[model samples]
Target: MEFFKTDKIFDFMGKRLPFLGLSSILVIASIIILFTKGLNFGIDFAGGTIVQVKYEQVAPISQIRETLKSTKYANSSITKFGSDEEVVIRITGSSSDLTNDISDEMHKILDSTGKFEIRRVDMVGPKVGGELREKGLMALGLSLIVMLAYVSYRFEWRFAVASILGLAHDVTIALGAIALFNVEVNLDILAAILTLLGYSINDTIIVFDRIRENIQTSKEDELKELINQSVSKTLSRTTLTSLTTLFVVLTLYFFGGEIINGFSFTLLVGIIVGTYSSIFIAATLLVQLKFSIGDFRAKEAEKLKSKREKEKLRAMYEQGTV
Candidate 1:
């Protein structure tokens, strides 16, 4: 359903500099945050024993840490899972044997806290975690390369480059948000990031596709105006799509429990950031890259010129005029 009248064209590109500047600042800040603070890597990547416990009463995280300090499990990371009664503990720099023996040791340690339940325990070796981390990074890198190849093949190298830039912008900010907020970097978060790549690129492609179609069909000579027009026309669709996605993601974030909180959070940020970059970053980039509809027109002209020349040569041959 179209929410806008045909004449209503939002000047999305008019203020690209401010938005681009904002994006640049955010990207740089995110980079700094990533390097300085780093991510909260979970046991899935950092190699640790995860102990999820549900207490009969409110769990004392500080007391639990104090209790572990005397034991081999010192320096365990303890945090609330979902409620005051639920707690998650991570013990890193320990061997897998410790993970297997955690049940006995934890029970002995927390014996004073009566009537509690061990919800779960997970163990990952350092070597395995490192491999997973390496493979995950490889997957992300390969996805970008594949997308570059695909977009270049389908459209032009310029479009591929522009879309990749937009995607990079989305990813950088999303990861930065994750790091800044100290979100757990695990297989789930990695999955969410990969999902984000697809979600973001889909939006970028939509904007780029409209620009391509408009360039081919419209007689508009001004690239900026064409881009503005294209984005304006697709604005409603983009808004609706992003809103619907936000609703679902927001729901998952709020009510899906802590298990998928990081996943939904990534999507939530990705959808908004992706939408913005597609409309502003990607579209504005086309203008900066000197996207010209005249190129297509030139190609068409060349084809017509070649056809006319062929016709003239055929006529001369038919007339036996050499």
Candidate 2:
């Protein structure tokens, strides 16, 4: 089960600068794309009409698109949603009871080709979409804040700070992939992002916990060497976990159908970035932040000292000596 021997000592921290630089450039590029290209927000946030139609027979997507081209709905985005017989049409704006108009138009156009049933037509107003977008952003912001607090409490603030930076790196990379590919962001994508944050933090916490344990137990003098050794020691666990997760995500991407494609795609990009951040971004930032064994040991000593003082005080009170 071990891909790397327990005694393995790869110098991951030795080549951290290059990785950090690479991550920085990626983050910057993602920001540029965010401003320049922007994300393709789906009907969930972009305020549009979603008309889901189910056909009795096999309805070719190209034929559907071609039929719509002759009508006002020609500019609509059509995709084979769940199955070969089910398709979802998304048209941005025009949501003031426009579903009927679209449904009638589609029925007239599609009646000749095949008898299809309009399963449902959902309309999202601009106001609702704006609210959802704001809520989504707020959720992401709150998640980061909560993760920072939790990591800070679990480890040191330095480790927590490093964890946040690492999560940001993963998120930026995922978002970058979506923007680069022009994938439509929907509720599923938002869920995937939240999942990514949790997953990435879990990886970061595992490594940070190892770093903390190593600092506490080992008398290693060189901080860089200590980090490198800690990372090397956990390399197998990280690799195995990430690969297992990646395999599932790849399967989901290939076979989960279009409905969850955004979700799978986000996870696919996220797993790689999260794994890299745990190894390079988080650990390297620790080195850059100059985390020393003494710092952690000093905190440990303070905790132990405080515990001993409380114990002594309790004993004195029992003996009526206080």
| Tens digit of per-residue lDDT, candidate 2, span 154-272 | 88888889898888888988998899998899889999999999999998888888988888889897889998888988899999999999999999999988778889999999999
Task: List lDDT for all candidates, in order.
Answer: 0.87, 0.88
**Tens digit of lDDT per residue, candidate 1, span 85-149?**
99998888746447457787799998776668898999888988999999999999999999999
Off by over 4 Å in 2: 54-74, 80-86, 97-105
**Which residue pairs collide, candidate 2?**
none
Q: Which portions of model 1 show Cα errors greater than 4 Å?
A: 97-99, 300-322
Question: After aligning candidate 2 to the native by TM-score, how far in Å is the CA of 14 from where it should be?
Answer: 1.1
Q: How does residue 26 of candidate 1 score in lDDT?
A: 93
